[model samples]
Target chain A: MKIAVVGKGGSGKTTTSAVLARTFARHGHDTLALDCDSNPNLGISLGIGEEATEALVSVRDAVDAGEEQHATSMDDLVSRFGVDAPDGVRLAVVTAIQNPEPDCP
Target chain B: MRVAFVGKGGVGKSSLSGSFARVLAEAGERVLAIDSDPMPGMAFSLGLEQSDAGLPDDAVEEYEEDGRQRYRLREGLTGTDAVEQYAQRAPGGVHFMQLGKARGPQWNNRRQHFGFQRLLDDLPGDGWSIVGDLPGGTRQPFLTWGRYARTFLVVIEPTPASLLTGRRLARLAETARAPRVVAIANKVREPGDAERVSSRTGLDVIGSVPFDPALADADRLGKAVLDTDPDGPTATAVRSLVQTLQKSEEQS
Candidate 1:
């Protein structure tokens, strides 16, 4: 099953997503938690240590900086960018644009 | 005293900005609360009945800038004029304006976005104390939505996630050459909560609003904490925050 947690900032969306993902994983589901927020912190909420969470490079940054090639498929994306969180949940951060250029929507 | 409240999502940016604007207005300062978040939470905090209303469609006009389609405020309208013409009147006489809210699957606030940006760029005079409530995370700050403000209030809670985001935002503010950046610790529950936030984010804690049940209750009831409990802990703390801000502005 897929779930998307959405809310305004400071509304516990990350916390809720982490809890739900962990719960599904413990219940024998192969869960994939996607941190799609520009300020991604789902790794921290999913029992990943702060240092490791911070060290997880986002797919967009990695690809944009030429550190890694863009994944050609969903499976490739998972294997290339996903980090192992607690309870066997595969976590991947999509993108985080730290500094967007002006007039470049 | 233009200020923008920025922090991680759910970190009380709206709550503080809304309350601060009202309190500032109550003190006889002309306040314009600008909500740049597409989610539009400032109206609720400002105790305004209209939650989804934004700048009118006529507020913007199509134009070509650098051979690209763009939107700007209709000619003959200044940012101050936009406020006087379209800003909503909230409790305590605070004038509130918002970049349009997201209506559906597609982001439908483009016109409002460009229009508000243009308005902010052309805001006239120093008569109004602008309090801008930016969207959560680093996206808006990185995009320079808060560039107009003289100060950036990076609200943070005593949590790892909040601290990380706050630290990132503070750094971004500095990189953007913001005149001043300070942290306002919110939902501080423990004795060391404020200190922890300060240390973690590397920002001086200007004021700390305690974790108050009244605030939660007010949020649950879809009301502003100040309206629900005017003399409550959160309100009192916010009031003190206003005073600190004003004093610092005077000195600076």
Candidate 2:
């Protein structure tokens, strides 16, 4: 079963989503936590850590322009962009804004 | 007025927005604060105990609106009915709603996001003030999303990264035709910090929240800043910001 957590900003949405996703994974269920927020933070929140989240390429970056995706299949979508989190929970970020800084001039 | 609180991540936008909503509500205005950020936190700032910030009853079903797929509160309500039924009341009589955040397939669906955006945009404008805490950065709000707001407030900090982000955010908000776009320098350690931000961004620096030990304690303990120290420095600055905005609205 899929569960969605929604709430106002700083309203514990990430915390709730992280907890629920972790709980499901612990219960022997195949779980995935999708981070769609441009301000993505579920990585550290879910104990995935910063390095792994930084290495994650959003699906927007993964899929090539004009590339055709199977109408009903998510295999291509997951393989190219998804990052594996701790405890068998996978993470897929939909889109992320690129930070415009490169460690100062 | 529809106001959007946006800026760099972790710049106290959520706290300021929630507090501003409370300030308006306490002043006898009907206020609805929408948590539109995906990494939601406005609910905690509003001091609500709910873990699920979406509509009550796990409402994430889809429906067809105008030949486009959209998400809705499952109570079969629209507009005012939806607001009245699903909005949760917080401290100072502010009503709160969270745009739903889902995982897996639903996360990548633009239709679902747009549906929520349409709901926010279609909200009754007159006699009601809507405050949304938008996701951090310029991309999400500028790409056909900032139109939902009449005014945009960028919360910045006394740092290179945050000021640069605030500059981009301010330009985007103005480009999107937000009638009013301004900035607030948060976590100011010195009086010059706010001046630096205003000079760099060229947008009015409406408020300056000091770096208070009480606020740090509140954040570390996951407590709302206002509730932790109602008369603290940061809260006082937030109140001044709200009052200034209200006065400007009255004048305009």
Identify the runs in model 2 with alpha carbons over 4 angstroms from their true place.
A1-105, B38-40, B56-76, B103-112
The DockQ leader among the candidates is 1
lDDT of every model, 2 decimals? 0.84, 0.72
Could you give candidate 2's per-residue lDDT for residues A36-68 as a string of tens digits?
A: 776566776788765566567777655544333
| DockQ, all candidates in order | 0.55, 0.07
TM-score versus the correct structure, for each prediction: 0.92, 0.66
True contacts kept of each: 0.52, 0.09
Candidate 1 CAPRI classification by DockQ: medium
Query: After TM-score superposition, what is the CA distance of residue B10 in candidate 1 from its true location, in Å?
Result: 1.2
lDDT of 1 by residue, B51-94 (tens): 65567878899988899989888889888898898888899989
